[model samples]
Target: MKKLITATLFATMMAGTAMADTTLKLVEVITSPERTETLKSIVGKFEAENPGTKVEIISLPWGEAFQKFATMVSAGEIPDVMEMPDTWLSLYANNGMLESLEPYLKDWEHTAGMTDRALELGRDVKDTAYMLPYGFYLRAMFYNKKIFAEAGVDGPPKTMDEFVAASEKISKLPGKYGYCLRGGPGGLNGWMMFAATMAGNNEFFNADGTSKFSEPDWVKGIEWVVDLYKKGYAPKDSVNWGFNEIVAGFYTGTCAMLDQDPDALIAISERMDAADYAVVPMPKGPAGKSFPTIGYAGWSMMSASANKDLSWKLIATLEGPEGNIEWNKRIGALPALKAAEKDPFYAGEQFKGWFDELADKDAVPTVMPTYLEEFAFFKDSLAIKTTQEALLGDITPEELAKQWAEYLTAAQQKFLASK
Candidate 1:
């Protein structure tokens, strides 16, 4: 009778275990059909491997993602796991909204295979990792061979001065512009790249935590942009052009060159002929230095998540070798997994430019001051406003430089004080 009772209790416990439900809400930041579908497929595999743990994907459009996510968080509708761009990762992690993955990473089998940079990408000021990077986005210059040949420019510009000359030459073509300037939203990249290149050093702060935008070299970089705009090197209408407009400008023969990340290739490849264009390392500054920035997107677990272990399992599967390669293949981003560096999918002529940038010892890879939550404000608002003013001849480069220095110094002081 006792043996029978034990068996019945064991069966009841087993049934209870099977009845427990753990649902993970995963928010996808990129809402493209292909990417969303690929994520669903990966989630399906994860669900199969870990029965009774279901993942529900919440898709957010890239355009409205930030505002919408802010609203969701304010509304207390936090997900179990969410796509975290490096730009937003620090902000979220710093605010204690993210679950630090340090403990989980120490025992994670996949952590051993991740690149040092990939592991470091999600680190906060205190060096605690809150996310695992899925992929990297690095800048390279894409140029039109047909336009170059027509402009009599022998090759891609090697220096900022040469870049100006090439742009001028290209602009001589009727109804064509030299550079596909991203003047609208997401235009901070062009501003930062040029400013850093001109400054010789990409570092934003000095030893005492002072900002560097007002430095003479950085001013020169801002001057270059202003000069280009006043000289009609870029389309006048491009002052309001964002990613779609800029890519269309390049692919439709409206612009001769564009400095962009590998992800831009996915869209460009669909519209432009391969033989007509090629990518190269960004042009150096007068100081013979080029600071091409790199950014990444990763997966982070919300601190509010009730199923941390299961959510981590989903992250591991998605960032693992097979899944990383598959996702990057569709996104045209560089896989953050170190082993993926040798994947055959990235071993193509079309990918040569990014590879060249990565291999170029002279080209320094840079990331912006994403640690500051106000950085998004600077990126999406201040930079755009001042740059558009400079382009319109409403502000001199020096004035623009001073404005940046004053604003960033204040932000830097606040950030340091908080620390």
Candidate 2:
């Protein structure tokens, strides 16, 4: 009897070890306190559902995430699952470092409920599903109602000219600027939006695969923003401001207008009263169209993952209708799942601005050239340097535009050649 009991105990111990061996590592690069908390909550549920299967969560600070994640991967310390931003998708997907999620997505119970845009962006790298996008970041104009009223401006600007006029009017007020320009990191989107609006279309490349940024219309768009800074319409110090600074500027009533994605709402709503602010579609330009930049971040499984099925299961749990909605509620992005749109959370007045932009024929959602593997470097380094110079009058808009056109043209052509 003693011998039989010992054998049974050993068998039970081995079975427990087998179950404990299924440990999955997840890294979230867009880390925020709220986002991390919500992620942990969702992951906790995932862990609870799968007994003995542990999920190790790593939250990387957004500022150092790119370089840090690259180093981690190179050092052979790869996570099974990762939060993939659009800018990083091309590099990893093209390098074959990411697992194609098409097969899993095909059989996912909630796959049909994903919006078309979500799937389209997920397949952006090589027309293959390397990531499952959780939400979209659509740019819109956030304006302070109190500032507008104080400046005697009637309402949100509807045209580029009106936007500038309102800015000038607001600038005349003591200690107030018209626009909270994101002139530092992550400013590329604003520059692209203005350039495309003035260029009369959101087309970045011509038939010959050359960038159209150096064209006269696009140059004017660049100049228009440069002039806004030079004329004191925006805070002089804003030339060094980034995401946090601009959001703070808007909520503090130091700036009358800010062009940002829905995520800004999370911060802005916290500081300012609901009645003090509102959002609107980006102002149209001479062609009567506005091109607001749209971006997204999603979940991607690493090709190096030993347990593909388990990794995919984690992705599905996070991106499933309930998990996705909960995540976006904290992240402040539009849900990638179509059914999540019906939730009362999105039906609020604040979200009306983005929904209205979606319905407006003249409001174009401009997607950046994220397919180019070199784009992350260009946006994070090259564009920031040159745009700051342009804003400070250290370089002419024409010079800046020419440099951008050359860089983008080369990148796009190289991408085309690879295909």
Candidate 3:
């Protein structure tokens, strides 16, 4: 009996030594309760499958992540793996801080299941892929079915004219507005989509790097939003509504429709019943075109990681078809793996709208200007303030367009010069 006990103790010690041979530190830039739990679950499964591997996750607050990550890099305390946002991709990849995943992906069987677009999303300016995006945050229209019924609208609108008509009818309901306008922080996506659809094209920059906001079609797009606000199709107070307020407005039935990403589904599902709400593609312009903005955050490996193969395995397990679907289920984003879209979970009403848009093949998928260093300031500060001003009638749409054109031109010049 004593020998048996000693043998067991020896085995346990060997197991510990084996695990100590490989430990991976992963950083998550977008910190939240839901994302934390989801990461834990994914890592837990990876650890179980690979007995000698251990992963430790370090989550950083979204607002301070850039500064904090820079400090870590300066200190040489880089993690083995990290959640890479699009805006930060050029910075890290260009600096040689991130590992190129092309070689690994070439040998990875799981890459076969991922979407071509997702695989290309991680490419650096030199065209090397350094990250593998797990999911897409693409825009779709979320409408309150009950409100539509009460307003006597037939169904979700397919054209801009139908959208305005529906909004007018829905606003006629006592104490309810037709649309929720995001006129506050992070409002740029809404503005861009509205302008893109109205213009029937989504080009932002010319070959010479000049901005298209000053163009007639894009100006008309901005005018449409101003008209909607001034004509009372949207609530006056909505001029101050950001993400939370607009989401609340939709779920509480204060607004009939909201154009948002799939991530909004998480909050909507918590407060509203399944039957009360549904999602649909963004309405098309007079020229029959629609553009929905697409953004993604992905997993990347540090170039200095001691165990590149094992680190990539962890990433594969997280972004594989099974893992991608499971992760997106909790985070409320669309899976980067195309096969995951066929899963039963995506067949529900809440997800059908986005699926329909993807199927349409004509609705353009738009990407923001993440290559510019000043993009954060432009998105979080200048765009919000100027758009709010335009909504308030403080500036004409043409004036707003001219302001945007000047700013973008200067920013583009700076970006090019730095390159």
lDDT by residue (tens digit), candidate 2, 81-132? 9999999899899999999999998889999999999999999977899999
Which numbered prediction scores highest in TM-score against the true structure? 2
Report lDDT (Cα) of residue 76, candidate 3: 91
Worst 10 residues of 2 by lDDT: 59-68
Count of clashes, each model: 0, 0, 0
Off by over 4 Å in 1: 1-22, 417-419
My TM-score estimates for the predictions, one after another, are 0.91, 0.96, 0.83
Q: Candidate 1's C-alpha lDDT? A: 0.86
Collision count of model 2: 0
C-alpha lDDT of residue 53 in model 3: 82
TM-score of 2: 0.96
Put down candidate 3 lDDT per residue, 1-419, tens digits, no spaces. 99999999999999889777788999998776888998999999999999878898999876567678888989999999999887678678877888989998889888888888887787744678888888888999998989999999998999988989999999888988889999885678888998989988888888777899999999999999989889898989888887778989998889999999898888899999998889889999977889999888899999989989999999989988778888999988888887886788888777888878888877888898876656656775778779889999898999999989888888787777776
Clashing pairs in 3: none
lDDT of 2: 0.93
Highest-lDDT candidate: 2
lDDT of model 3 at position 77: 92
